[model samples]
Target: MSPTRSHDGLDIGVSFEFFPPKTEKMEETLWASIKRLAPLSPRFVSVTYGAGGSTRERTHNTVARMLRETPLKPAAHLTCVDASREEVDDVISDYWMIGVRHIVALRGDPANGVGQRYQPHPEGYASTPELIEGIRKIGDFEVSVSAYPEKHPESPDVVADIELLKRKVDAGATRAITQFFFDNDVFERYVERVRKAGIDIPIVPGLVPVVNFSQTAQFARRAGASVPAWIVKRFEGLEDDVETRKLVAAAVAAEQAFDLVDRGFRDFHFYTMNRADLVFAICHLLGLRAKPEEVAKATAAA
Candidate 1:
């Protein structure tokens, strides 16, 4: 059977991605977001570690707490960065012990951060495919890796990017989740290329709701995603009005999401950025309803 699903867009599935909190207040906010979104019954939620294994301990504590207290399945993000094979293996084993059965395996940005030349540790897995191989050897993890709709910044071209993805597939990646894109046609084209390469794993679209337009544009620039001029025009001059910006953000996100559904996409992964209201509103616009029992479990987990 396919590890995730054959996303012909017939059956809907949504997943959320969250980062480990850096402060107690942030932690409270994260759990509250989880509680709010839980009733939508996401396929799974994922917790991310920072570049170079930073936030490692907090990530573990959060995922472990989820397993103990929530009905949601948490996918821990693991990276090949600044850590030896043994160290990475130990972390994977710990996740297994805590019942984390899924992982978002990645070749993380260089320790210095993005835009620098990526350097693999002398004793670390060299790339994402090797990371996936290592993860699978340690346990039967439902692994997901990143895909770039706009070719990765360092990749010479889209062909090379897709080639690397095929390697991840051969190395046992269960599915591919993309970076957020403002243009749906871009995602569709990327998927077509991936399919032509003979990779059938579900390529789930990642959506990021715009909380602040200028900030989102900056992030997109760094991540190799383009913010279309139309999007810029929509958020134009709302800089001072936070409330109005939010309304615009919701309308833009909703339009993007509903358009994808019309284009026949069932599986989605949201980069929640630790805020729930905008994403929740968009999902509700997509016609998803909350589940009562799941909501109770989320409250208890919180």
Candidate 2:
């Protein structure tokens, strides 16, 4: 189904994802994007944790700052990587102490990087299900877990992937955010399978605007998400033209979002990559507008 030009009265909920910045300039950029998108009143903004707990401290600081300084609710990402059970539990306790109510729990990537074999820390929670259970024991957190519509790279098959997600839900995951995919049909089929497996929690579609086609394609490969041939053709020969690329990216994401809305999907999670232009534009296209009160509040916070 093609996206229609009009979305006159659709009601859609949105959330955004950001990674902890590694540099001073990136930090400024992250907050700028936050201030720019805060007026839209996303359901919640999430900060990503790096593999092997590499960004644990940065993620904590970012999430804590967001909670203390902004009106936006932040969901912190927690991963079972190099940390032991005691350390992971301590981090969970810290989040609870700081008034954080939501966490995205996962068994993160191997310490080396993606595409490598995942070796769990002998002393840490081995899998996401274990991590979810640990979080529940530590606090009453509304937990979110990763869902791979395309099947996780390490999974033996799609069924196994669904089974893993079920384990997470059984352990107390309240929601699931999918890995980003270019084809909406892939997501639809995955959701159907998830339902058939008796996993009924909200499976929020993760939408990524292709701000840089090449970079996104690389990420898609690593994350086990497919970059459709049609999408590749759309960005063909535009490598040297950044302005056109941004326009194309916005159009592509808006179309995908509108198509999903037409398919009766209402909630969306955008992997913002710490940039607001594309996501903000796509949200605008989805019939979302900045409330006056929210705008004033965001401006004051800025």
lDDT of 1 by residue, 197-287 (tens): 9999999999999998889999999999999999999999999999999999989988988888888788889999999999999887777
Worst-scoring 10-residue span by lDDT in model 2: 1-10
Model-by-model lDDT, in order?
Answer: 0.89, 0.90
TM-score of 1: 0.95
What tens-digit string does per-residue lDDT give for candidate 2 at 53-140?
A: 5489899999999988888889999988888999999999999999999999989888887778888889989999999989989899
For every candidate, C-alpha RMSD to the true structure in Å = 2.9, 3.4
State which candidate has the highest lDDT: 2
Q: How displaced is residue 278 in candidate 1, in Å?
A: 0.6
- Candidate 2 stretches greater than 4 Å from native: 1-7, 52-54
